[model samples]
Target: MLSEEITRLIGKSGEPMILEVERGAIRKFADAVGDRNPLIWDDEYARNSRYGSVVAPPGFFGWPVKWDSPMPFFSPIREELITASIKAGFSRIVDGGIEYEFFHPVRVGDTLVAVAKIADIYARETKGGTLVFSVTETSYTNQHGVLVAVASQTLINR
Candidate 1:
């Protein structure tokens, strides 16, 4: 079960993080995933595609790292939620699932801004034990301020 403090964190958004969609990063991600799509690796092939440039594969959102900031990529709100969940007796954690909605292709050289928020917190009872679930929703926008994608991830804690 979630306590009041933990539940209160729901719907609270974290600070926005900027991520540059570099060509190398996109290629690397595709390689790591064993995706050999020409659009991800061949610039010329991608140039003729509808996207008009090298594009990131599905689920290949850019990383959020700040070279100058002392703070890590994760926002304070996320850390707080984890801490509170642990305090509430959730010891083990597992990824429940992830759902992504893409409105546009993520092309190389495009800047993406991501903002994450705790969408919900709840608990369920099973034969093993009570499990707490937290849902996080992140919205990604392009440099032109166009909403590009939205990803929702669920985490389960026991």
Candidate 2:
């Protein structure tokens, strides 16, 4: 179980992230994921389609990470949640899974704004120990201010 202070952090959001979807990046992602869809790569094919332009794949939302930075990606609220869990005596962390819901089409050259929040936190007792589950939800909106996607990720601490 989490303390009141930690529980109070539910729904607290971190800083908004800005991401740009580029044609090259989308194509690279599609190739990396072994998806050879014409809409994701062939500009000529995409231009003839209804979108009239290359559209990003269903799961492609952000650009590739630059590894030169000292820190990977920082989320203050998420860090605080992890610290709280550690203080609660959890030593091992495991990634549960992530679920994504797309509302609008994400296209190449579109800029996306994403904000993530702690949605829920709970614990379940098992034979080994208590497993604390933390769920975070992120909302992705395009430059037009239209909500494009929502991703929920779960982390378990044991």
Candidate 3:
């Protein structure tokens, strides 16, 4: 069961955090994921492609962030949400899923601003146990003010 306090947290929006997209970071991430796609790390290959330049893989959109200063990244927005849940008498938390809508490709040297908001909260009874789900919506915008991507993530806690 979910408490009213937690329910109140739903629809709460957080400040936007700036995420720098470096070409090196993109290449390293590609290497780490074993994704040998040249378009993701090779400028020459990407130049030959329609994109005409190196771009990040879709998976980077869901990269994990840490609890830092001024603003919070949606990927790790649960930092505060987890605190609220624990205060609401929840103990464990796990990722349910993520749904992403990409408007533009993440290119190197692009700095994006991401804002996270608690979209919803609900309770469900499963064969395993009772679980509470928190849905968060993270919107990403580039320095050009272009809406780049939006991610809806569901977190399960018990």
Candidate numbers, best TM-score first, in rank order: 1, 2, 3
**How accurate locally, in lDDT, is each candidate?**
0.85, 0.83, 0.78
Better candidate by TM-score, 1 or 2:
1
In candidate 1, what are the lDDT values of residues 6-83, reduced to their tens digit?
899999998888888889889888889899999988889999999999988877777765733344545667777888
| Best of the two (2, 3) by lDDT | 2
Residue-level lDDT tens digits of model 3 in 38-111: 89766798889987788888746433335554433444445677777887767788889999999998877778
* Ten-residue region with minimum lDDT total, candidate 1: 67-76
Candidate 3: residue 27 lDDT (0-100): 80
Worst 10 residues of 3 by lDDT: 62-71
User: Which pairs in model 3 have colliding backbones?
Assistant: none
* Model 1: CA > 4 A from native: 67-73
| Model 2 lDDT per residue over 104-153, tens place | 99988899887889999988999998898899998889989999999998
Q: Which stretches of candidate 2 lie over 4 Å from their true place?
A: 64-74
Q: Residue pairs in steric clash, candidate 1?
A: none
Leading candidate by TM-score: 1
